[model samples]
Target: MAWFDEVAKFNTPQLRLAHITDCHLFCDIDGEYFAVNTAKHFSSALTHMAQQPLDAVIFGGDLTQDHSFESYLLFAQLIADSPLTCPVFWVPGNHDEISLMQRISGGQIKSAKRLIASGFDILLVNSKGPTPAGWVSEQHINELSEVLAASQQPAVVFCHHNPLPINGYLDKHMLENGPQLLNVLHNSGLVNHLFHGHVHNDYQFKFRSVDILSTPASSVQFTKHSIDWQQQNMGASYRLITLERLNTAEPLCVKSELIWLNE
Candidate 1:
């Protein structure tokens, strides 16, 4: 981990990361488990990723079923097997334990982290609260402001919630301080894209010129633009985040693949 200084420069020229979210991995495949067979799905993803040249694994959130200690252990073990010597940073979700997770996974896994990669700064913010309808604390917001203030280059911000109101119904369930977050991002003008989870559907949109990309669930698929998605089949999928230096531009052009299992 001493190489953190060297690796932060994005000296790789180009980089790739895998974004997987809401795996809800459980030890059991059945027995009213969180989502039966999520572990199997993750195993397939790990194996597939091993064959790729990805640099890192970025977990969006909701990595477990009940935020249990056992589930976190299982997650750590599974990630350890991934073909990654690079960094794999994770933010907290409603289904994850911030306290127990830090005890097991080394240090405190906070709501977010600001990462520098591929000559770009990536900011991760926590969007989960006491419930699925998420919220961010004022303290977290102030800290993120500082993170964004440090650099004036395009960065990718990831969280468990999307900032836009989905059809404007039940918008309260979305990011409580989404406008505030967007205000900062807009002011900075360095935020090129925003990636998020918790919606369970793969979506793409633009937020004040910033691309809003929401990947499909790592263990399920939901109806597009639906309010209540109960009958959706829980298919396994992930995103291959690619940061490309297009024609040698200042800000990296980002592209991603929606890799799906059990199609």
Candidate 2:
């Protein structure tokens, strides 16, 4: 069945979503990445998310570390077994396979890229590239522009790569055509915010008027500007975001908070 076959309505005044990223799951159930148990941390994230009354959940990207199909299956199984009833919108990271992700999506994890919730249009961008670096093609930019041109509603875009540079070691892996993306958003005048994952740590900045946020990884986080992983006690984290309009005559308001897991 298609993801949008049965469209659901969000009657609430506000729409809330939990954004988790960089799960980096392995094929082996007990496998560990950099001494961190990816599966256990992801499971913990799911458990925590299930407790919240969320409208949706966004899996930011980097769903696997070893690029194994079984790892994707493990990711699907974990979501299916979780108590979260909200839809999961996802994008592919550099480490993920497009075909495998599509195959497992459409249930808890939806395959749809465009979402309409609470009077806002949430669009997902695919920034995955052939290499570790991110790239957004001209076609994608054009499509996004066309969509924005046709819609007067507020927009929130989600993607796997950071469109702006952080001036660190990870900058090489950022979106190659970030300036083009910013150009579109700058011209659209409808996009209020942009959220992404690839950085492995929390980041906040502004490109013109758009507020950009990067979520921390659910498995392990990399130290900023470090060439190697310096083992420390950086735990898994996720972002909780709420979108609402105080009045019919006003612009949309966005509020976000970063939550860190004790595990």
Residue 106 miss distance in model 2 (angstroms) = 2.5
TM-score of each: 0.84, 0.93
lDDT (10s digit) by residue, model 1, range 1-263 = 11112223456556788887887866453313334467767767777776778776778888887555677777777767655455566767767776765565542222226566555766767787877777877777777676666655567788888778765333556787777877777778777788888777777877686788887777666566655544355557788888866433666788887887764
Encode model 2's per-residue lDDT on 211-262: one tens digit a residue: 9999999998878767654444477889999989756577878899999997
Candidate 1, superposed: residue stretches over 4 Å from native: 1-10, 27-35, 82-85, 106-112, 168-172, 245-249
Clashes found in each candidate (C-alpha, N, C closer than 3 A): 3, 0
Clashing pairs in 2: none
- Candidate 2 overall lDDT versus native: 0.85
lDDT for each candidate structure: 0.69, 0.85
